[model samples]
Target: MDCILCGKCLEVCPLLRATGREELGPRAKADLSALLRGDAVALDAEDVARLAGLCLGCRRCREKCPQGVDVPALVAGLRAEHPDFRAWLWKTWLKRARELWPSSGMAAKLIPEKFQPERLAPFLKALSLLRGGPHVRPFVAVEALPDLRGETVLLFSGCTARYVRKEWRRAAEKLLEAMNAGLHKDKFECCGMGLESAGFGPDAARMREKNIRAWRRAGKPRVVTLCVSCHKGLADYADGFEDAAEAGEWAEALTPISALLLDGRYMLTENAPARVGYHRPCHATGNDLDHALLASVLGERLPTPDGRECCGFGGIMQLGAPELCSQVNERCWQSLAGSETVITGCSACAAQLTATAPEGVRVGHWLEMFDL
Candidate 1:
């Protein structure tokens, strides 16, 4: 591993800004890994462990870096080399919980009933009222489109959205239906983003195979996902596989819901109330097409100054590093400072921002704002 020491990764690193520690940056970590290969570094395991844990794995650096270093993968490799039981426990338990009780009903049972919003800032507390609190609804699978219905187009609803954020699926289905596109529901599983993040690639691969076979059944018209993490996983499905190109072909195509929604052909109603601010999830913003589409959908509702800021949820990073999550959110909060409501396509972003919002700010899904 050669370290070019390009500060590109540091520019978008949420953890670096939160902790004010340069060593935690991707280039620094890459350099340390390079040194460990040549010399017997004296750094203790605890210090090494802290550095690995600090990464949010948002992959923003991967897009910015000219050296083409896979920073998230490097960090995952380091964490696997020096495994931490606590981190493993948290990740494993959460995955198991999601799998076993994969429904919003389970989330209602798991989350504390009398949760104290006071534990967060008053602004966050006020924003929580807009969402009405965590409630579970039944998961409704996306139905295949009627006209020009393709035999393919697998719909992969990852575990989190399958259970906790079912409404997003509803929104996606509505949008796709409007496009006259069909969706195949067979042979799909969770996209394994949680497993990949938790250093359980073998299991993630197994799940990926199951979904691939499902897509193959329909000859893979196109893969559509409501979750940004799942969208990224589908896009990078070919990365390490020997038959990557062939396996990736099984997807035929992969797209987020926003891409379909903002196709320009759709006659989207433009009359909506309240000024909206768009919060770009790290995954969506990192991709050019999805980012642009989401912005276009927001249109004039999008806040002028800093409408493109990240909400800083980063999958399970909010739970893993709460303080860092808060700090990163503070930047987003400031960017969306004067908006009546903040809108985002990602449920994780919505939840995290709502949890940490400052006074009088409201959090909502972009679809909810429009009559779509």
Candidate 2:
């Protein structure tokens, strides 16, 4: 009810701005949520479910809203109340994608796409290739250090890192081991970002419970992840378990590799001097930990380009609305206009940017700057 209805969210919304779909904007979703909460219902359960599927979950809507309305959560409720086929499919098969393709994204093929087989094949192949690319890799893998310092920390190997780009997991491990900290590896499931996006709150909760229990079983030491989405999901769950208002403030609390460095827990003695640019991801926000930590680790080697827009890997949006995803992602690639290598912090961004990167332009993670 606090929404000033200033329409600020519409102006910068990647989906609305790119596709000009006013109905997909936050205001419309909020209105729909209100209707679901009461009477005078215009949309039936099916129509309501369609509207819920039409979001990027980028939180730009809430970020830009003056009222700071929890539109995403509201839409999530509507989605939970209405179980559509697509939601059901995502709730069911997305887990398969995570588990079966532990080293690839072959599961994205399940999404109903509008493209011909030839065109779609290459995109799926490109997604599968997200796990490859030493040319675009930011950090090199180092052997585990022998010395140990602090107690073990839980390293949540997100699906993308586990399957698509194992280097991300390797990088996280290498970096952590350098800090003299032992690792607590578990048979953890997906962090529930995809399930949450699909409105499968119960499914998402189960995954969250598994992770929470993993933490409990592992002694609940400090936790960290290389994947931004996983980090966001885990942190949000922890915060929600504490307070509603703090729920989804995950980026603010989730410990990225950057935070460890800032805390004197990890140290980068030197950096390779390279003329490289960067792609700022949505999940890398909060206290500018990514930017500051990169500067400290990379030194004068970093020359990131301007603009920090979404790479169009908004979980299900890429699968259900590829065209809109492409348009928004085109903007991100464009931002890398004059750079040699584009570095980012999120696995999804790395994958999307790498898939569509221009000739001679490589996309990588910020951790790649380390010599290790």
Give me the candidate number with maximum lDDT: 2
Q: Over the stretch 101-199, how does candidate 1's per-residue lDDT look in tens digits?
A: 343233333334354423223323323432464322221122222343553455666664565556666666666666566655656677766667656
The C-alpha stretches of model 1 lying farther than 4 A from their native spots are 39-41, 97-151, 239-245, 248-252, 264-271, 285-291, 294-298, 304-309, 314-320, 370-372
For residues 1-372, could you state the per-residue lDDT of candidate 2 as single tens digits?
555678887876777776678887888888777766677377787677777777878776766677878777777777778866556555655677556455445455465665455434434655665766534533523333334486677788687777656666787788788878878786678888778766788788888877766766776566777766667777668422445433333234346666676544234333332566777776544565677766655567666545446777766555456677788887776666776767777777777777787877767777665555
lDDT of each: 0.60, 0.67
- TM-score of predicted structure 1: 0.79
Q: Looking at candidate 1, what is the lDDT of residue 46? A: 71
C-alpha RMSD in Å of predicted model 1 compared with the true structure: 5.6
Instruction: Output the worst ten-in-a-row residue range by lDDT, candidate 1.
Output: 136-145
Instruction: Score residue 370 of candidate 2 by CA lDDT.
Output: 54
lDDT of 1: 0.60
